[model samples]
Target: MIRSFAVAAIMAAIMAAIAAPVAAGPIEDAIAGSWRKPADKARDQYRHPAQTLKFLGVKPGQTVVEVSPGGGWYTEILAPAMKGNGKYVAGLANPLASVNAAKSVENFKTKYADKAIYGDIGIGTFGKGVADIVEPGSADVVLTFRNVHNWHMSGWDQEAFNAFFKALKPGGTLGVVEHRLPEGRPDADMKKSGYMKVSYVKMLAEKAGFKLAGSSEVNANPKDTKDYADGVWTLPPTFAKGDVDRAKFAAIGESDRMTLKFVKPK
Candidate 1:
């Protein structure tokens, strides 16, 4: 009877192990960091920082360049994750590009100057025929989050992709997370709405000499009806419509995002 009880206890322990949540790794640790604002933490439900980084293949010791890191949301996680072993380069428009772009980069640097939290982050440049964001073939990973639409609006989408392609090492990764337009939508909608077509984005990258590697729905939202009055800004974070249908947008959450990976041939 004692042996029978012992066997049952062992089986129970094994089952418990299987049921346990995944142990926090470096990326997870960075996402759970105390330095991140509560507001930023709340977005993790939609952002899925840990899973997104894993999909992008961001690893320690890699030279990671984040293009147009608006508000430094990912910077908060990446800086700490890369503090000791790697570099975090923030690629924004060069200070000479425009007043707003210059101020934005300045504000970002001032906001993230804390070495204890953000490490020694570097600055790189793109846009406005400003040239490379980093040295040719220097970066292991180049990530752009939801900023592609702005480039499209600027009519420099091709230039931006060319810059990204130039910045990456051969066999390196270019990870893009952008608001997605449905396949059936008119291509012109991309210019009006903030969302873009996967095919169009792929064409841009391919024009810049990148081969598609993979794509993920980790940030997909089926509830986004994609016909908002103010485009994607009509959603929760922007709530462009003010109180009108705020609850409806809140329930819908963030826009559906396409998480794509492209590779520079070795």
Candidate 2:
């Protein structure tokens, strides 16, 4: 009996020690805590915050920016998450993205009041079609989720990628999550299917003077078939098919996504 009791005590001590080293700090707490009961239902369709932020390497006392914070999905979590020491900025696309920016700002303020910080999410048109908002080298990390395909469709992939690279401080991290296509797919496939070629994304980042840090399967969907007929939009989160074949898609869940972390050169 005594030996069993001692073993249990030792196990408890080891667990606590492991947890202590990686305990979520103020920023992480604020970010994760924002998803309370009411919001939990919707979060299932959103990117998993724990996995996404972990891959982004979000830490307390750092400055982070979320690009095109559509519908304030991530903004709702990032504001209070960085309250005590870190700062959270929502960098929306310029005049084109004003409607999105205003909506995000209002939602964030209602959720966090002034505890969360914000910057000029509105920037006028720049060379060609680039946004001239966020300042250069102003952030520690910039994250964009599931928005790259839209940019590619609009022919602003390189422009947006370069903007992210220029806006971060030397050695700042850029985290990208996009619907992914299988290797060797045609460029035409990207347009039909939401999945982008991983090589294309890497080359774009490298050309922007950023280094590939790492990648994760946190959001990968194995069932994705990478076909032209019904690309990523065929999946649940998008469900472009809408009751056409609900059961088949319900089994597939979300689109297969690539989660990559890149860093701007120092």
- Candidate 1: misplaced stretches above 4 Å? 1-23
Q: Which whole-number lDDT from 0 to 100 does residue 165 have in model 2?
A: 84
Supply every candidate's count of residue pairs whose N, Cα or C atoms clash at under 3 angstroms: 0, 2
* Candidate 1 clashing pairs, residues 3+ apart or interchain: none
- Predicted candidate 1 versus true structure: per-residue lDDT over 1-266, tens digit per residue: 99999999999999999999988766789998998889889999998998899999999899999998888899998888988889999997688867987898889889998898878998998776866888999999999999999999889999999999899999999999999999899998999899999999999999999999999999999999999869999997889999998898999999999999999999
Off by over 4 Å in 2: 1-24, 31-46, 96-128
lDDT of 2 by residue, 101-179 (tens): 4565555445545443432222222222554436778789988888888888878789888888888899999999998
User: Relative to the unseen true structure, what is the C-alpha lDDT of residue 47 in candidate 1, on a scale of 0 to 100?
Assistant: 89
Q: CA lDDT of each candidate?
A: 0.91, 0.73
> Which residue pairs in model 2 clash with each other?
30-81, 31-81
